[model samples]
Target: MMEFRMKRISRKFSSVLAVISIIIISVMIFSYGCVKKEEKEITIGAVLSLTGKGAKYGEAIRRGIELALEEVNAEPNRIAKIKVVYEDSLSEPQKAVSAFNKLIEIDKVSVVIGPVLSNEVLACAPIANLKKVVILNTSAGTEDLRKAGDYVFRNRESAIPQAIKIAELCRTTIGIEKMSIIYSNSPNGKDYQNAFMKRFEELGGKILQIENYKDGETDFRTQLLKIKESHPQGVYLAGLVTELAYILKQSKELNFKTSFFASAGIEGSKLFEIAGDSAEGVIFGSPAFDPASNEPLIRNFVMKYRQRYNQDPDFFTANAYDALKLIAISIDKAGYSSEGVKNTLYSIKDYPGVGGTTTFDSDGEVIKPIRIKIIKGDQFVSFEKQEK
Candidate 1:
């Protein structure tokens, strides 16, 4: 009887132990599945001018966004892994529209980063707004963009602020009572010209003459001659890099002695190469981004950019970098969906960026403080304001 009872007890205890083991194993498997579910994935798109007149700017912007992508993925607490799709806009309006459409319908990306020209951005704005897709333009700064749509946003200031700043400098700082205007026939140029003229005249300055040259026109001799005939105290050149350089070169040839002022359109080493010594004394308004800045965020970015690209970064590069990182953060705060990101963006007050502190107005437009810089000995440096 005693031996029978011991055997029964031993069998029963073994069965109980096996049941407990199965329960523990089941719980472990469920936890693993939950963790796997938490690690999500998202996708974004870029429509850039990969092969066209604006290719260089687009390439710089691409480098900026890529660097941000790396940082975003490497964060340990990131809620999602992100992938980017690229489409070449060729820097044309019609091409930009096609790229925007494909990204929305085919790639199914909710957020997009580029199409560097103002015209290209304007072309894509309607579609993006209608589809509820988010577009953060890196370089386009036309005033018309202020009313483009609720879904369209830009990293830099519009033509109005830059134009107003330059106009103020011309009258108060440079003490120019009379000035002439030379502009390109593009939207970017026209916006700057219109705004600057209105502001300068408001400040009691007189406009001597206004001249315009078509886009892709390498020659500005006729316009320069006409400007020289005005013989104003200063000339506001609202043109891009190549055209501005040519204007400076030709203006120098004509001995058009006057103060040269420009909006934020003229930049890059190529300008110095083409304009040569004529680039000197060309003052322009620039967003406050100095690579040598001691601010840790800026310093770290400059170091990383140099290490990767083996070159110093510029204004456009910095803007693009900020644009991508902004999207990533907005997505994290909200979700990867376009409506989520757009709502979060509207709630943003002041965002600390590598370039500067960015704050978007109700129109989805941002305006940072502008720094006055002058070309001195083939390099840009801070210009000192004169005492009143």
Candidate 2:
């Protein structure tokens, strides 16, 4: 009996040892810079809304990422051949968490590019911090991301910068002292509305009324009626292209003659396609990217993007291209470890990107110039040019 008990105990001890060995090996490879020279390729994960409501943005972003991937692989001084594994987030929080777990566990990726929406970032950022995985957010611009731990870094400016700039422009430039806000009733939309409201109020503007609508709602007539009744000098919209386009179109149908304003993220060609002439004269703030730019970096990126995608790169595409380029640069400079990537990204200073100069602050938020843009005829032109 004693001999049999000792045998059982021995088996249990060996099992525990095996588990520990596996964990130690995992930490060495993933947590620390213990990559082998023989390993020629490193896999990174991307969680994006490949399908569902945010699909348009995802497709545009995918184009930029693919272009960058081809360039990265063909570089003569490349660190390692990089592969990006993508999972559909469906633009939902729970789905994003699942995608993140699968990437970190099954795919064993130390870095991930995105959970495209702001709420998705809020959902996955905790796990990113706990697991020591790096997140290079492609386009989620809520202010809350500034506190989303060191592992989270953004490729684009947060809604705070653009929101603040738009509010200032509305007050100082457009001379609109009162407006009404229509925003999506979600994490991202709420953040954008709140930022703009606070700034506008500080500049002595009165928000006649505030209204929120659920995501995926087609008809915004009811909200428009309420906003129209408020009789504000202008109306500020904060939501996706699908919803915002409809809002602009319906506002015109209702004959609500107020000027229209929006956030940077809403600048997409689809808006013009949907709203037609209603989209003209709408003002917003953006992170200074001009497809017509004479700058070599901007020109090259625009040319390549158009040649490959057969479409002009918008805000989403510009950020996605920069995100991939930064990721490759980070890996080359600081190995494939998560900490190495995080530290290197944070250390970046005024790195000229197609989007703008990218320099991360202490909170991992990108520092870039935000300029106001106006929809004129069929283009987003610099508002300053009109002033000049």
| Candidate 2 lDDT, 1-388, residue by residue in tens | 9999999999999999999999999898874553553357999999998988788788778877888899888887465789999999998889999999999999999999988888899999999999999999978878889999989999788887788888888898779999999998877788889999999999999999999999889898999999899999998888888889899999999999989899876688888888998988998878767777899989999998888767778878888888988988988888999999999999999998888888999999888887888889888888888879
81-131: candidate 1 lDDT, tens digit per residue: 888899999988999999999999999999999889999999999999999
Residue runs of model 1 more than 4 Å from their true location after superposition: 1-39, 385-388
Q: Candidate 1: which pairs clash? A: none
lDDT: which candidate is best? Answer: 2
**Local distance difference test values of all predictions, in order:** 0.87, 0.88
Residue 174's lDDT in candidate 2: 74
In candidate 2, stretches whose alpha carbon ends up further than 4 angstroms from where it belongs are 1-39
Q: What is the lDDT of residue 18 in candidate 1?
A: 92
Which ten-residue region of model 2 has the weakest summed lDDT? Answer: 31-40
